[model samples]
Target: MRPRGIFWPGVAGIASGALMLVALVVTYGNSPDYEGRNGLRETVEFYRDAGNRDLTEAMALVMLAAGLLFLFFLAALARVTASRSSLVLVGGILFVALTMIATIAGAIYAITASHTEAFVVTPGTGTVALLLLDVSYAGTVAAMVGAAVLLFAVWRASRTTGAVPQWLAWFGFVIAVLCLAGPFSAWLTVLLMALWTVLAGVVLVLRPPTEA
Candidate 1:
């Protein structure tokens, strides 16, 4: 497999990941801190305010876009690893499903955030929104786990088939270990995975195809 056809998918993956990271930072950085149990009201206010609505929308849209692009990246990865190991293929597919779930959850939260006025007006709506946010975060955690599994499988495949360098395999193992640390480390795991994805894409583009 030449990987020539999949090159654009790699590029799209990197671009989307970059955009998602930037949009996420911009969305959260400018917003007020909404941590702790007492922070729900503040979160409601932040979303309700007209000035912050645009950032909320951007975050939502970018997440959705990133999710779509991530699918492309996963497909390319699965194709690359298919000949190397069945475990890698399965892990890639699982990761794709979990990531899609996370993306949908994120989109739902965005929709909820966009309609803060309605949530505020209707009793219990805010609670529901918060619950949705929790679910979205949970989905993110699960997706990260799926990514960890994929990376681990990739590492195993690399060891057997030499599809990727040993150092890269070790790097994947380290990231996978971090990802398995659960929700508290999710953000850091995500950032690391995003960087890894970009680097992997670049490496795929540059490396010559191996003979089957």
Candidate 2:
């Protein structure tokens, strides 16, 4: 396919990145940390409000949309890579899968918390909620592994075929490395990924590869 095919996907990637930032902001601004044991207590207390649940559900929906858009972005990159699309496909699939898992896990926690009557605070309720939250966070980190793989694929393709500029391709390498630190840096990985996707989108749209 011609590089022209990348235009819509590149646009979608930019939108995805914007939505990701929105989701990140909503999450941090509206929700409790939900990190440690104390965070669990905060989560329990915070979700007592119906408004919080509504906002969380909205954020989850936004994130789901972002995930799908990111997939479209990856598909465009894979199309450009042609025969080398396999690695991109693998990585994108894994990334989207984990994103789904993480979003669902968080949504379930928020949804469950909304129904105080249905979700009575048993002695184990807090622990279960905490586990769900942990799963969401850990799932995000695991998803970064897939993102790294996808980026590495992009970097290799760029190096071989000059699909993208050398500096931007190396920036992919930098973002991939930052992805590894997702576990330690809260939503820093999300921020970097968003920036990279936006930049990639602009590059793809403005400088269509001659060979792809």
Candidate 3:
């Protein structure tokens, strides 16, 4: 937790991004019916049946790595010569907690994928419909909530002009807002989320602490 150097967080962020990119490639062009769409059933099956579930699960696990890296980064940040009770601490806690929650959701999604595999074999249209609908509801709620909490943490950090940049926090806050509207626009929300992640990671990696 002792502050090693500002570059350490950058290293961790890059490492996390590497792991995530791998997961993304593995799951590229693949996703499960864990979320239901009126017409996305066939599309979902194509991904799962193409032996892409592992890829999806791998992506899910990357979140665990991302969470750990951030944990270390935050720990180091917490050791800075400032108020330990500063917004940085709150932001750190939120990131850690929400990342863990997201990790859990990923685990659940992997388990559910197995069930979908079997359902694929039997071709149970009615059952598949129900499962997809259920996933849509549960997954959206989990993702939205976790993302919101993480973004809020960034917003919390934003208050500490020394520890975290205001722009990064606002970006995160906007992404969180987008995520809140997932029922109406999940794709847009995800796009914004991805953008926020990249921007924040970069900022955290490069920003130096301000003079108190």
Candidate 4:
């Protein structure tokens, strides 16, 4: 099997994660004193000023595209585990799709916070700045959940040597968990996820062929 739609969801996932890490750097550079900004208007200004809005927005879109690819990869992987049960396979696909939507939405909303704006940003009120942060928070959470479930689906695929590699499966699991804490250390999450993609590609290439 040529792995159907794409041969590199895991790789895509890792690359997208790296973009986010870069976005974080771009965002942090612009965010002056987060704690000191006590007004709603100021907060918005802070994020826009701290980040290269254009770069951050473009990166956000990239993250969304990568998330979508990851879901497709999960679907291809699930086929190896479903064992002829169309119901299980369909359900698995649904889960991946839902995760994709959630993650994309989150990345878009979250990344928008990092851009150039004329307003001053502060942490005081429920302003646009705060809202963007909240959206990002929710989005990251959704992406994390999706990754966890996708890992399980792929694990089932990895049950036999002909489908997925056991080590690669484990690697994804670790990366999924690390992504959850990306806000704390985007660089760390990006590194691990990058390793996951490379390992996944190697696994897919090495998987034993199944009877047609």
Among all candidates shown, the one with the greatest lDDT = 2
Best by TM-score: 2
Stretches of candidate 3 above 4 Å error? 1-6, 17-28, 32-50, 74-120, 124-137, 156-162, 185-187, 208-212
Clash totals, every prediction = 0, 0, 0, 12
Off by over 4 Å in 1: 1-4, 27-32, 83-85, 107-124, 209-212
Instruction: Tell me the RMSD of model 1 versus the true structure.
Output: 3.1
Cα lDDT tens digits for candidate 1, 169-193: 8888898999878898876776777
TM-score of 4: 0.58
Task: Give all candidates' CA lDDT scores.
Answer: 0.67, 0.79, 0.54, 0.49
Error of 2 at 47 (Å): 0.7
lDDT of 3: 0.54
Per-residue lDDT of model 3, residues 32-79, tens digit only: 444446435554454345355455456667766766776655555554
- Residue range 150-171, candidate 4, lDDT tens digits: 5555555566443556777777
> What is candidate 4's local distance difference test score?
0.49
RMSD of each candidate relative to the true structure: 3.1, 2.6, 5.3, 5.7
Candidate 3: worst-modelled 10 consecutive residues by lDDT: 121-130
Write down the TM-score of every candidate: 0.82, 0.88, 0.59, 0.58
